[model samples]
Target chain A: MSFDLGLVIEYFPRLLSGAGLTVELIAISSLVGICIAVPVGLMRVSASPTLRNLSLAYVFFFRGTPLLIQIFLVYYGLSQFEAVRNSVLWPFLRQPYWCAIVAFALNTGAYTAEILRGAMQAVPRGEIEAARAFGMSTALLFRRVILPRAVRIGWPAYGNEVIFMIKGSALASTITLLDLTGMARTIIAKTYAPVEIFLAAGLIYLAIVFVLTRAFRRIEARLNRYLLHESA
Target chain B: MFDLKGFGDQLLLGALMTVGLALSVLCVGTILGLAGAIAKLSKSAPARFAAETYTAVLRGIPELLIVLVIYFGSSGLLTAAAEAMGHDGFVELSPFAAGVTALSLVFGAYATEVFRGAILAIPKGQIEAARAIGMNRRLVFLRVTLPQLWRVALPGLGNLFLVSQKDTALVSVIGLEELTRKAAFATGFTKAPFTFYMAAAVLYLTITSVTMVGLHLAERRASRGMPGMRG
Candidate 1:
């Protein structure tokens, strides 16, 4: 009936370590995700049928299924393979941390690729043609012309993806990784105060998302400054 | 490595449970979504705040966390309530309820956006047109606004449903005997996790792939006679 501030404070230190783990997982997967997304996004819009189709199927499969299912498939499914055990890859595969990262990265890559593909299309075609007219090489044309526009267009959505990856790290708990959500669950089982712990964790997540949304909004404002100045 | 007999039954059960859960969740979620979307667009500021906050919280949290929160969190709250009322018994949330609630929360959030977007997409002129014909506000919304909104929202709702259907696997965390849980149970019994998980994956892919075509058909049918909508 009465709110228990002292209980919440007592558990705050315990949950802090788990929050740290959650941040690290999200940060690692996010950096790796950009790496995977840029190339895959490029491939999705590539001139080569082979690359495009393969990339298309990869995006389709990953984005279509639940991330939890995908995580289990990678963690448990690969462990079942003899060749995987016999191969040198088991060293990486055997660890839950790496498996979680790999799954999170692949999952984020699929979603990010779609975001980037849409952003890539948003870049003005005439500008790319203009770059070509100036005898800009393909690499220079992409680096100078395509990526900046795509990056600008995709930043808001990419910012949402950052919030998403932070939340998705909660699933690593299922694989026995003690992220924030997982720690909260353990704390709840011990204290039987699920609402306090879970609610606290949710607030932590909300705080992270709020910060991210603000950062993205600032970037969007900065990007639109010239339009704002002209209008004024 | 494959346990043919068990695999047959588990896959069959998993598919049926998954689809049944999805259909149930879809119906509940859509109802919640429709009301939420309407509330969101209503003149009341409190309504707007409630709607916005619900969607933001639901969308921001992982489906898995939502599942855990309600699965454990809600029950904790309920039990505390009961004890306070001097009821000396525990209240357990059936895994099905947890699954449905978790998914519906996610679905409703996405659907709120879809429905709100759809409602906004309806031209102001059409409402004016209906008003010119002496239509009431209810008549304007129902006769002029609602029909077009469906066509605009159907593709998005379809996508949300597809996402929710896969997300039903999240109930497995609470030991629900849906597709993933059933597979995990089978693996425990058989000790050969590969075959069962592969079978579950194939079943998921089949459902998702088939639903995509159905969604495409629904979108095409809904968008007929709309202008500049060749996609």
Candidate 2:
């Protein structure tokens, strides 16, 4: 059959709303994930063996398993426990939306922690020494010298984590969140036109990811303007 | 509160299927990656653009959507094309085939970058030296390029395969009876979601750790007798 433009136009609003929920899901989870990552990452690089090993275990467990299983475990598995159901946290855990956020945040947190840890280690030792030589306190040294440099060095990879989180947010659909893919699946069920509906869905994702990557590239360039002169 | 009795066989079967699917995808992905790298490196502008777009589009989209589209969409397209070719039958795309195709496409897109880097890492003078020794193009590639490319690409490809292994779980969404699906199935009957999923997670972790050890051994083997190489 030939292509039908009419279906796409008719379904655009529904698809747009789905995309909105997707954006909402991604934005909130990624923000929480980054917040989680920063502390975990710091803990990873800390001198204390207890802290470092605990952070390493956290990263290992999350990174080892598939995200799909993680989502199922949180969404379906957690509710299986009577203690959890009777607890004050049950209200939040009962919702698929919250379960998704929990899973995405935890999973991305593990990855971002590793990225930040690598970036922290990669920061030039000389710069760190200079700050110490000036008698900057540990807090001041990290605030003024370490974090800024680590973030600049790790931003590109962190940008990748953002894109991954977006792509990953699609998994929320599987848990009944009615995100972009969920909307597309619903539309296809009604119209019996999987190709057209899914293509539209895919293109919308492409556009968002395209915009995100471009924005990241600009930020990376702006961050490294000082190094640009030497390279050119 | 947990029992795996009588479910062990099913889980084993599912894990085997997971490995089988991963291997199929790896073969397809490596071929596509090699071809994609060549196209991107080629002089033809159209080839370069096509390769670039392939990687960008595949990498940009969600792997689940790709699997859904290929599994559900291909049947209609294939049937239409079959009719156009004077055939008169409904064509069905197996979930296995669709899963393999989709997973491989995702695998290949990332692999393209790995292969491209590996290829570029081979120095120009080495190829020139091989040519100067009167070696043909095929001999040069087999004797020089292929060996170095394997060493350089192994770590990246090993990581990709592990990621792809987890991705194989996504195929369960499209009705493949892989590890994740089987776990879900058992969870349904036993009403023990945590037990089954945790078991599946441990199984996956086992596969990952085993493959990692294998990869470590392979890296050591490849690096043997080479200066500056580490264990």
Candidate 3:
């Protein structure tokens, strides 16, 4: 019933070891998510109804459902089919690690795409018109004018999604990956000290979030440096 | 090719439970959020510090860890308390109670910011006018502050509802027989993981879509007569 400081100190290193996979899951999924998001986000605002609708559906389905179910669909559901089990994709699909990555990437991609779409739309229309007035091509205008402004606008929200991704990656533990939560569960099973182990795990997560928050604030400051004098 | 094996009713019940749990958490969370917002905005430094710590710690950690910690930790505390009371047995917290506590904490943390922003969005002149008209603090809040707060807070709260609804799936890990757990059960029973999970996903989407429509209508109603406001 009492707090077990000694037990937490003992198992702190074991919990810290799982930080690697947690960081890896966030990094790879975030990288892959950006790849999917940029295109899908662009498609979201495209003039073509078909492309816009397709991306809309993608974002809708992914955003509408839970990430846990998505992970289950990939990890447990995919292997249920004879075709998927025998397909070339089976090798990667068979691993829970890859499945978690796929689910996280797709989930974050949907959220980021929405954020990107909003940010892109919110880009000052006059800026785009000015780029056109300068005779910049569509691609050049998007690259120089729209994307940078959208990034500046979307960066804070994207940072939130990343933090959510970090929290969500803990669900990867449910599928048996030895992430921080998984490790905490494992140690608790052996030591019968759920409170201590989970407290330690929570501390580690808090540390990760704290560091990321500071990093995001720094990036936001850098991005908005030009607007500083106006605000002052 | 995709039969539910007559578990359709089971899944429906589970979906209902999911909705019920989400609504309950939303109600509790909204109250906590309001209190947290007031505390944060209050002049008392200790009250603000406590509210700040509450949101910071709850928002920073994973909901899963919260669920696990509460599920296990509360039981341990309860059993110890029971032993001190001369009862010699283990005490367990029900999955429902644990689920509600954990999810509400998470929901309330995010909702605090939403409510705080909504509260701050109210024009200072309105509160001043109410006070100038001899309204007490409580009456001013009820008649003046609460009405406008909902208009601004509805959208954010709606989004949080969607989030908490999906987060109900996380409670399944603690053995709550919500939609996700029912699908998992059916999957085990029928050995049809894909069919059941896909069905669950569809069920979730249905709930989400319905909630979205409902929120849209609510927002429209709440923002009625507000000039230049987009419903």
Clashes of 2: 0
- Candidate with more favorable, higher lDDT: 1 or 3: 3
> Each model's TM-score?
0.92, 0.94, 0.96
Which candidate's TM-score is highest? Answer: 3
Task: Quote model 1's TM-score for chain B.
Answer: 0.88
- lDDT of every predicted structure (CA atoms): 0.85, 0.91, 0.93
Model 3 over residues A36-71: C-alpha lDDT tens digits? Answer: 999999999999999999999999999999999999
Cα lDDT of model 3 overall? Answer: 0.93
- In candidate 2, position A203 carries an lDDT of 93
Lowest summed lDDT window (length 10), candidate 2 chain A: A1-10
Label model 1 with its docking quality class.
medium
Q: Could you tell me how far off, in angstroms, the CA of residue B92 lies in candidate 3 after the best superposition? A: 5.4
Candidate number with greatest DockQ: 3
DockQ versus reference, model 3: 0.81
Show the colliding residue pairs in model 2: none
> TM-score of model 1 relative to the true fold?
0.92
Docking class of 2: medium
